[model samples]
Target: MRNLFCPKCSERIFFEQGRCARCSQRLAFDPLLLVTRRLEEVKPCSNRDLIGCNWSADEKSRYCCSCALTRTIPNLGSTKNRLLWSRVEEAKRRLVYDLCRLKLPLKSEANQLSFDILSDDPEEGPIMTGHSAGLITLNLAEADDLERETRRVAFREPYRTLLGHFRHEVGHFCWDLLVAETQLRGPFRLIFGNESQSYENALKAYHERTDRSYDRAAFISEYASSHPWEDWAETFAHFLHIVSVLDSVAGLPLSLESRALETLRDPYLESDFSALLASWTPLAYSLNELNRSLGLGDAYPFQLSSVAIGKLHFIHMAIQNGCGISACGWRAAPVPVG
Candidate 1:
């Protein structure tokens, strides 16, 4: 993620900062431009500001762009809903930031697969999505840590965090990109199998089956066993997860201040998986050691299968080729399986 700052005060700002600390200026993020600017400079937008949006008007915008994605928001009168909505908005901004950096296509509110947020209850009820509309909706209630943790355990997930959600959904977006293209679609289907299968039935079968053994030869994670499309999405999310984590721990900087900035800009994804594993293996050990000292769980809790390694290498190649950059100045295609 890009390290953002308060333009007015130059104060280091958190990704979710609504107001600058030093300058106290109202801040707004332009997801398309991938920059946060002062709200005062922005002109009024045509869209109803019923949702608590902080986006500023742009040269190409009829409304504040971030507000454009929200189809519905939680009721503001409820304090719990408001707080949860705030967190969702913050995470959504970071997700948009990464998408912009990657030059990924973002669906507008008018299009299918566009982002939406809504809520009805704080527990077991909130935003509904994953229907055929291609919408990625967030239930505002899930933003509460306690509520989310409860749900996470109820769902039997080892990890369930905001970043994970963003990465997973982005996987769905990538599937849309690759599977919709004639050149890539055939290859995708060949690797992932026919996506026309009933998704609900597949999920039901996955839950009902007693065999918990994951097909390590074919999938990236145990959860990937749920379905063919899920297999791809899990792998895709893991690809991003590895890249982002590796980016964070790349190298030592002059100091803490410099380290944070450098971690945000380092080229962890611009190397082959072989080299990455070489670096990450030792680093993950060291990370676990430090976590152990702190009494925290292992930061990464998966054993890298040969198959998984191959998939990582493919992801490495994809990003390198997609960005038109050579991985560590190397000029060869990596031999990795799907």
Candidate 2:
């Protein structure tokens, strides 16, 4: 995601901040523009006189941009719900911000979209990660690292994280875009398989068989090995994961020079995977080495497959088309990974 700063003071602001410490300015985030503007200084909200949200206090009206997208927030009476819901909002805002920056479409799940949210029986549930009727539901519990890690270990996945959840679910959303478009549907079918197949049975098959030969050439994760749509989601998530993480690493102190090299030529948009990977090689190496110094595992846990690269190519194309960025042309031919 692109970096965010407070417009008034240029203070680095967190996505969730309602006020800026550096400038003492109330702020509101514009979800459409993925930007935070000073409320007191610019576009002061008319509502500020009545409701007194910080944005209103600053004089900008119409719900600081991010809050406008909220169809419903859990009742704020419960402190626990308020805190957990805030975490959800922060992550969701970042996700939506990137979507906006990429000029991607996001309709409310209520607006006839394929996405939906379901409440597990309040008494008994995994407490996170639910899928129904094309809408993936997230339990607020996942925002807490301890709970997420516990579930991750219990699920026995090599990796699991909040951003992973977002990217994966978005893959399902984008599939709707491709399948509905006449130009892309046939190619999707040829690669990802008949998505109309029984999802439940496919999942059961994945869970029951331990010895099934894994198809690395076509998948980014083991769960992806279970189904074509999953393959797409896993790969899509990784594309976001890598790009965002690489940008974050670039912002760190250790590798400013390498960061310059990778982004200097627009590796994120370039169709040439070899050139992109060359830029990434040194960064990934330094990342792993840095992790080792701290007694941690590799910073990135997965390898890119030829199949995954093909999916990434399609994703990159979709993003470019979505954003109207024509700096680099896309390739229709699938890229093969050795």
Candidate 3:
């Protein structure tokens, strides 16, 4: 989420901008360089004419890296589905941007990370959003603000959004990528618990329990307590959340003399986990207060306890180590059913 500017006119731009507003230069995001470049001939992505993707394409593949990962999309015959699909792609591209910035290994086409954006059309039955192995499926309905809000209220979740869903499910995929077979597995088990435990039974017990006491000190969310794997995924998701947000607000003049902010670097490349947290704590607190003053809900509703911090450290270490492995060498685990 680094600030981008149009090279033509120097006007501020965004990750998804297709044209520079001031100079009318065509724009495309260069995933490799992690910057928006002005395109002279507008060598737009194949999806550009179809779904409005503004990214540059790979000369060999003719699809942008992010769009290439989409295995399936909802029915485009309906105008509603087309709009929802575009929104989903926008969020997915942002997720890919963060992943690339971290220099993590991405699966190739032989065993690529794929997405299936499905709709909740009655004929298609209910579409449950979840990740399996390297493939992540999302419900297109979640793109609708009202529908997403309704589900958030029903689930009693403090916060939920399309980007959060992408980050969380990708966490599951990364666990399989970076932790499942590595030497880190032992340490991961020690911190998150035995992932070998029955996920189905744990989820059943979680839903049946009457006492919904969430010890924020121990768990990031009540849903995270469903199983050891879930705990790992939730912690992984939060690690991304914290670092990404921190990166966005790192050097802002918040009118406070803070050492952490003064020496802030890119959180993705930050080796010291504690220093990142030090900066995040005060920033999150101030954001929550700002939200309250505006009569809005808390911007950051969760608290990171010592125990939770330990789990995040494990994720940070895993990612730091895993990024060195060759993308093709990593094996994909079988997708768990049920």
Poorly placed runs, candidate 1 (over 4 Å): 23-25, 43-54, 59-63, 108-111, 120-131, 243-338
lDDT values, one for every candidate: 0.62, 0.59, 0.78
Q: Which stretches of candidate 3 lie over 4 Å from their true place?
A: 108-111, 251-338
Ranking by lDDT: 3, 1, 2
Q: Candidate 2: where are CA atoms >4 Å away?
A: 41-77, 108-134, 211-213, 246-338
Residue pairs clashing in model 3 are none
Q: What tens digits encode model 2's per-residue C-alpha lDDT throughout 44-106?
A: 443333333333222353554434544444545656655566555555555555566556666
Q: TM-score of predicted model 3?
A: 0.72
- In candidate 3, position 272 carries an lDDT of 77
Each candidate: how many clashes?
A: 1, 10, 0
Top model number, lDDT: 3
Highest TM-score model number: 3
What is the lDDT, from 0 to 100, of the residue 85 in candidate 2? 60
Q: Estimate each model's TM-score.
A: 0.63, 0.61, 0.72
State the RMSD for candidate 1: 16.2
Question: Where does candidate 2 clash, by residue pair?
Answer: 39-58, 40-58, 43-60, 44-59, 44-60, 45-59, 45-60, 45-61, 115-135, 116-135
Better of 1 and 2 by TM-score: 1
